[model samples]
Target chain A: MNLNIEVNNNVLTAMPGDTILDALNRHGMNVPTLCHLKGLMPSGACRMCVVEVEGRKNLVTSCSEPVMDGMKIQTHSARVIESRKTIVELLLSNHPDDCLYCERNGSCELQKLAEDLNVRERRISGNKNNYKLDVSSASIVRDPAKCILCGRCVRVCEEIEGVSAIEFVGRGSKTFIDTSFNHGLNVSTCVNCGQCIMVCPTGALKEKPHIDEIKTKLADPTKTVVIQYAPSITISLAEEFGFKPGQNIGGIMNAALRRIGFNFVFDTSFSADLTIMEEASELVHRITTGGTLPMITSCCPGWVKYAEEFQHDILPNLSSCKSPQQMMGAIIKSYFAEAEGINPADIYSVSVMPCTAKKFEQQREEMTQNGISDVDAVLTTRELARLIRLFGIDMDKISPELADSPLGTRSSAGKIFGVSGGVMEAAIRSAHYFITGKELIKFQVNAVRGLAGRKEAKVMINGLEIGVAVVSGLKNAEILMEEVRNGRKDIHFIEVMACPGGCINGGGQPIGTNEESLRARMKSLYEIDEHDAIKVSHKNPYIIELYDKFLGKPLGHKSHHLLHTNYQERDVN
Target chain B: MKSKVEEILQQYPNAGRDSLIPILQSVQESLGFLSEESVVQVSKFLKMPASKIFGVATFYNQFRFTQPGKYHVMVCRGTACHVLGSATVLEEIEKYLKVKPGMTTKDKIFSLEVVACIGACGLAPVISINGEFHAKVTTESIQSIFETYRNREV
Candidate 1:
């Protein structure tokens, strides 16, 4: 299977499965590539790797073309160079020359490729296709003009995460990646997972800007700016500051927030434990009262948005309890504000999440029950990284500090809520306790753990079998729904998270999370859970105190007024 | 024998506006044309106004609401096909038919349309006449293809 290849007049040896690019790279030839990410397959769309292959009619994209025996490949022949130049020029024709003001100017792959290819001027004079920038979500932006239609976003959504929210619509020059029925991301079945922004080559996808608002708040002497960091953020945030992925910089993160001049620093995990108490009670009540079967977890904002958009018919299946962040927001305004004797309006509750959909979720009119939004502005992990750098905080050199008390002391079940299947496991822990009134000997529910695209498990509770299904990706959710529509076996409960690895790998988290980082982060999450003294949410003293003081109890009249929400059917057409 | 309209209605049980293009395309591919009876069946199955369906079928370039010519000539305008001078081949086809793209000859011998990438970029400048691919096409090749179709008609 050995092949003798002559690329760029230099002889090289290759194997049967080696691509033309692979052979050239082995020979120390540096060819330009943009869409060839290490983990993903080469899409051959950039056309920068064009090479003239002997016996082939035209220049073939070397990244996709396999090496054959005695193949004479010309990597930089006049025709091949011309083809590459033309492709680069065509790409440049639509690209704006606003790199000076761009956030990712020097770091952008597309910008570097244009410079490497020496594209001084665009040969084509076609008008650039213009689109109104979409800043509706907190963590992501959509600038269609900057998009090259390389389909890196679409590929990542489908291949990496198993969600196909964005797809190529129309033909040729008119083609662009759009949500189904050409609707906006807010209206479409988009989970706002922000993975698309991470893989995007240009500024077409970016984190929603909240630095200005934060700066304004920091400048105000009267208003108190409170920031709460999700549990998963600490494990993933270090990667953005050049620390290796899954490096524990929790103390450093707390210090950074303190350095950022926030009036109060809190942890969402405290509210996460509270969410478990409420969600767990709801699950038990449904089981006892013969309510909706397969009650879905509504913690992940992206999954909730997807449920509202495409699965409106199944709204009754969604848990009535608000997400941990929203629950935290509500608690901060009502309980914390009342306890401190401060005006709820003056206290700005900001949640730092590894998700973009939380931004949109916060803006929903229903979320503003107590006159003001429970959560104000939201920031992704990357946005927080940018803010940290702006404040001149050396994240590595800083010492870690503990999160604020009362709302910061959280159980192991609360910490695990950052990862996929964590919500189901947390609910099950509390549900088991609430139903049996005795602690389950085995806390770990192996049935609902892992990164399975579609996972299902059955547990017998009080002689009643409860069927549960976990869906991480929206497309996988679609497949599961299709099965349900086709009269598949009825289930008692389901948990759906939009992101593949759930909130830990949220769209707003730092990119470049490889297999090693994923494994490390997952390990940290389980470690956090196992090392904790309180593994169950129902056992959390703070949650019990909150229920006794303010909310009364789970599904109480006050809890229902502030924490529950209804879904609306979206017009797909 | 069941009318062509009845045959179409049997194929699409729950016809709607969304299925109109696919159904009409399927009917045209099978019967080689849209007949009065088939149109009625489409109207009935889709529960759509016949005039509305007809309007849509005629608007899209892919739809063939009327009868096709004796010869179905599709010149690919895909990126690969265009790079290999399929435009010139199409021009030669127009010269022979004395008509433009998406037109049928008075003699009902030739019809033409430019299709997007047919996924046959390896063999550039491809032309398909009655579902047969003729790769690496030229004016001479197009002329020969037309003559072959004309002879078959005769």
Candidate 2:
């Protein structure tokens, strides 16, 4: 039943269990909120959403208060506005005075709230917090001094990600969010998914940017700086450059990177095609040779780390194929360098990823071969956009160009690897070929597609029924894995991406991207897949050539050394 | 200490959210304080985040994170005690014992605690040395009180 209520003299209807904030939002009445995250339980800790109600002595936080029948509320009374202004001013008093240099300078929610409420002068003055920045994690940075104690990061980490790597420590005014025992995140069971950075309203939580390292390598003439962009980056990168979201700026991005002093630029999708050739062959080998059943995709480094920490027993189940970025790095240093007669040590390989975990992934010991690391520096899609701006390149005037040859060609199946179920769909296409020696009539496995946290399907390939599951977000993956651990032998293959919507919504992409932008980016990939002639990775000419000339075959001796790696169990403690 | 915590945790085979406070209380009562190890154990037992356990434990004054000394000293800082120069008495005790509130003396003879009120308004400006209340305590009386507890047998 719906209850009729009056908000600021307007009659509104609210459903049962709807908070006052919910009713107000339904009526298009906006109230200032900081600690309140939609789809999460209302915390009411911020007190910025307080509204006056008739017969109530004190202002009540609309987010936590349920709308009762005939409850007259004043959402924007002078008193309420004054109270919200004071709350913002108090937060500013203790916050650091580094907005000019902060990562969220132009996009900070708290700063925007101050502007909305017209908070000009600071009425309250207090000593600023002197907490040291926690820079231990390769993916994220924690600046406690800038934290406003909104508890958004803590809630998102615990509630959504199900990785309670951080929580509020101490009490009252001395309170701050930190991992258990105040140790840095490297010691904690942090999966490095970067969800905390995605929800942070302020600059308190941010990706550990590698812009300077990329620039330093670019300036060094001895280092032949080469960069590769992830499959999802081209679609999502447009949003940062003032272009509409999901505009395929792949060609323009290539033109921009060349102007920024890059010696060469390649597509990670090419290696994604290469990854499929290896991944599908490995799956086929497992199925035929009585190897580990239910092989899990290890493309997402964040998920690999999660498996290492929480589900060590499942480590053997993870595919040994390195992520497309790492695979590209491996080939570039060995195969690409050999072709050009350049010393591998003199080459600086950089990757522009749609993920923050790639920064951690490139530094993995397994990713290095014979004293040379595959990839040198990893930059987020946001960092690439920042570099483009730093070079003062005019995006509008630049002509569209193609990526460098040799490693430039990729198939539509490889391009779809940016989204959640993309890897499984791509692998199934090629795995069918590997097993039956013929391509499937239908290229797309419609069952394993979209933004759902988890998807499962059964496919008959060469009369062998293969059970497959695709999961995004580690929490969702844990549920599917628990079923697998219980000896449920139906599933034979699994794909796990730590980021909820896959690399399109990766942590390293443009920050503050909503659902609309995610759909747009995902749609762009699907469109590219639909229009391209080469839809199967096994059919890509370069991949076939690479296997014939340099490598003997998929899962062969040289392929194993250059492209594959192993993972070890890690202690959460 | 480890066995005691494990025993308490074992009592609740499938503890949920509601069992946290009682578990914390039981652990603190048995061990005289909640250690980091006990907190971690309780978090695992209840399936609660350690930060939440610490947050809940710190909210109540009954739970102490550190061990209490053999002779726990409590000086009242309530309104009635403050009106009777209890601040000076507390300062004198801290100076003579060389320990601040919530800290134990090097010799383990005394530990200082600043309590809000002991509900003995008539005995204003009172200091309790190991639960033995001293009424109408003054700055000069703190030194003699320390001497009395320091020389006592274990």
Candidate 3:
């Protein structure tokens, strides 16, 4: 068989069995496609990648076709270009024309395709999309008006996350994506993870805006507005301000938040350290006292909701510690309110997170005391960038500033909670100390680090083997849940995150980012851990002070009242 | 009816994900239409999300959600019937019954549904009521046929 295929007067290497799209893509052909996700099986529903081939009756969809040896292919012939242009025009005809008001106006893939293809006019027209917008969920809004039916969100939700919250409901032209029985998202089995928002090409899916309420709070003179940011947002949010991906802009971010009318700024990672402290002691207590064996970490609100909806039987295995976002929010109202002489009612608590699910988690009935919610509002990384822009805070001109006293300082152990295996590693560090009263020879548990969806490691604390598993993305977590269901007793601890690669690449971070950027963010967290002097959560002075001054100890009564809560089985069926 | 659905699910002991279609078909055959509870039961049995099951079930015309009315009406819209003016017959029935295709009347006595073919080309413009056939129907004669079913006569 011939080894080469002619393309536009140039011979490119074409593997015998590779699809033409793959061959072209591999050899640096930048053919645009709307429905093709790199690793998934191509649906080929959209003909955007269609190419003209010699001796073919119609344009061949490059994504679905296998390359034949010595087959002549033209990726951008006049006919192919016209076909692609027509496809875009048709999609635009049905799409909403309000781009200026759209959430994805600047970053929309369809808008980019329209520009790249030089689509100048409405050459074709069709009935416009008049589907109703679904704003029932607190974390996400689904506007069917702008959906181009790329199926990316549906594919990722079903194939990767294994939560088919949305699906193509009808057939043919009547086809539209909907929840079960075309119901509202709130009643559906959606975990509010916002992975759908990350995959959506248009503004059809977006984080439910908390910006208006935040604006109201920021402008209110009576309310003392205090804000905290998640561990992952520090590194991942830098890219939103045109900084290099994974740049640690934590100090500048604190300064920016202060400029945006927040009276006080705090770091969520401090509470992450607090979470580790409570969670570690809880693990040791459970293991020693013959409580639940495989105690799952509950740092990720998305994973917690998923467990509540799908794996309700194993709710006993979940650690009752509140997530760092809620932890800091609760503390800001309770401990910080008392110390600063501010009433909990007057203090408006806000958190910036790399997750949309944090919005849902903040409003949980358990995360409230005396009708006062811990977190008043939550902003995604993208929304924070929008806020910074709206306030005209020049990130480049801003000087770095430290977070406020008492609730700000954190160890690298808490900071690395941005990554997937971070919680397990942090908890193990404190658990080892809590158990043996000594530090591990090395602070870094390298076995459970990096971008893998799942990782396992064994730890020896005084010759008692402790087996641990860390999984991000509910699909990966499903495997371990099945094992536990089938009575596998060897595993003792589990860490689950709803988004893959952890909060650094969470659904509420920057949209349309590649894997390389995620790797950079992951690498930055590890690097921070590597260079920091305080490697363990137990070593943070503020945490030790917090325990000594206010909360008596881990798993104490006050800690249970403030930092720990129970989860119940949520019926999704 | 819910217990019958559960019993139907139990028959397929090897009921995994792929067995969903057969289970859905069996349940629908016994119950006449798919119910919300049946879909949830199928979800539990197959260990799949109910949304996924609902989605797959809605893709085909063979599966339906609403329960059939006491006297289910089927108007054949096949090529032979359409050529013989079954469209007008369907319109008359819809007009008389005051319900569209796949919907039941408010009183629960009559249901109207359109089918592609009844395989009786010789008896063109045919409609079936509770599996009993009526041949060569028209707009004028349609109201009388429904009156006969309403009166419980042959």
Candidate 4:
């Protein structure tokens, strides 16, 4: 084999160790792929990318085939197209024919492939296998009938999240993805991260939607339905309404929710500020009072559940603060209810979040009070978009509206809770102030700011140099956890977000999201941080006023009762 | 059962991920099948999930998931046996036993398994009761074959 390959009479250079698809892609030629995921080892399970080689008798899967020197390649020859089109038609033969009512009707890769390959006729019709829908998981719903057996969800759950909750069960035509013992996902070691939902190309995996339940609650006049949206939700929700990737649609979202008959709209960033106040105070107290060193952040429910299941020993190292969504829900049920003279039971608290695990997080035992859940319903960012569309509210015509007062205001520190390292940056700002009574000169901590799965930084406050690490993605978190388990010191605080790049890239954010959108969302969050006036959580007036009136101090008795919680080890695995 | 699973895991103290199939086979050999408890212990030892372990176990038809009964039955489904009407003979055993392949009887009296080819095709359409071959099995012969084992004490 030579160093150069001829593709359709054009000479193309092949890099060492480059796959045929990689070389073609580098030369601006694109071949469709179904089971291929970037940054993962190619399994060549799906033959969607078949290319013709000069001397080869049969077509080869370009994703797994290495480029040979002095080779003639035809990417879309007649034979290759026939093979691809036939493959799609065969896959559709057994696939359920319910695209209109399917959750992934618009975004499904299989449907798109059928259209792309012009597979208009059912030349190869076969019997459709009926599969039982698995809706046992709190955060995700699984419809096995719609699955194309691409194995993307299985691979992502195993390679990226390291959860391996689902696997390719059985063999041959009888093969399908299933949990252990075929006993649904609830009994499996699934952490409810929703990452599999994000990677799934079809509607087989989706967030367990609360939109229908939320609509019933909204129509009830006797119930006061108030909604709270996570900090990352505003920027990510724009893409669903034909807006830009990182457009901040908070104001329009507020107006839309109110127009949809929500009694009040609250920003979860307010409680994010509340969380920072308590979490930073807890970190400082741990340092000075000789409490557990290197207190990990418990803001991401996916990470919390992961630690509970996988890292049981590190439970004490986790901060006792509830996540921002749950914290806001707790306050809304307790303080907001009493102040407004409304019964907590009559108030149906709804939260819109970017992460699916927040759905599971809000339903946690400690997230409720007196048999009533703090957050009655949890809608994903995608679900919130569907709700807005269901109401026929045109977001383009809606004007920017402010969040309701008392429990609605927040600082930039609270707003930055959307991105991966945002929690650590916000907490560091407050922890610095809590330790030395002075804020840091630079609010943006550059070391922990990028989309890298893991990052580490250090800060000097009053001659005490403290080390901190920020990690996103459970697989990366597993590596850091190994070091911590092996007795690594010098790191005082660690922040972990289960989804890669944090809430902006959460499982419930949006379908058909790409790398560019993720980067754009992160940029928009930082741009907001760079310009906002109140840059620290302590400076939020609502938080300050709450401390003075409702709560005595951060980590105080009342704050502990409402804003803090504990975690118990789960033996699901 | 947990301690016994622990003992099997102890045999592969320095085992890694690749040792999974061998270890699973060993456990199945001892326990007659891969029990949920054994799967959990193997998962913990390999630092993997039981779901993945189950997937691998189900891929090959060799592994069983249910305990074998006192009289384990194997029916050959090879090309020779299949052409000679083993399908009907197997169906008769399933109907008489009231259990599917890879499943045991409710009373733990019999466990029936369908094998792709046990290489006993010289006497086509064969059935084995406790490794004792009843060559040239017929559909009507299944009842009398089970009656022979049903009346016998362990």
Q: What's the residue-level lDDT of A425 in candidate 2?
A: 93
Better of 3 and 4 by TM-score: 4
Docking class of 2: acceptable
Task: Assess every candidate by TM-score.
Answer: 0.73, 0.90, 0.92, 0.97
What clash pairs does model 2 have?
A294-A492
Cα error, residue A113 of model 2, in Å, equals 0.5
lDDT of candidate 2 over B36-134, digit per residue (tens) = 889888877777777677777766667777678889889999999999998898888889889888677887667788899998889999888778999
Q: Cα deviation of A334 in candidate 2 (Å)?
A: 1.9
Choose 1 or 2, whichever is better by DockQ: 2
**Which of the two candidates, 1 or 2, achieves a greater TM-score against the reference?**
2
What lDDT tens digits, residue by residue, belong to model 4 across residues A87-206?
Answer: 999998988888899988888999999999999999999999689999888899999888888898888888778888899988999899999888878878888899888888888999
Badly placed stretches (over 4 Å) of model 2 are: A1-29, A51-60, A65-74, B30-33, B61-77, B80-115, B118-154
Model 3 chain A poorest ten-residue lDDT run: A1-10
Q: Which candidate should be chosen as best, given TM-score against the real structure?
A: 4
Per-residue CA lDDT of model 3 for A451-554, tens digit only, reads 88889999999999999999988999998899988998878999999998889878899997778899999899999999999999999999999999899999
Off-target runs (Cα >4 Å) in candidate 3 are A1-6, A14-18, A67-71, B73-101, B117-154
- The residue-by-residue lDDT of candidate 3 on B65-94, one tens digit each, is 888899999999999999999999988888
Q: Is candidate 2 or candidate 3 better by DockQ?
A: 3
Write one digit per residue (lDDT tens) for candidate 2, span A63-113: 999999999999899999999999999999999888999999998999999
Candidate 1 residue A101 C-alpha distance from true site, Å: 1.8
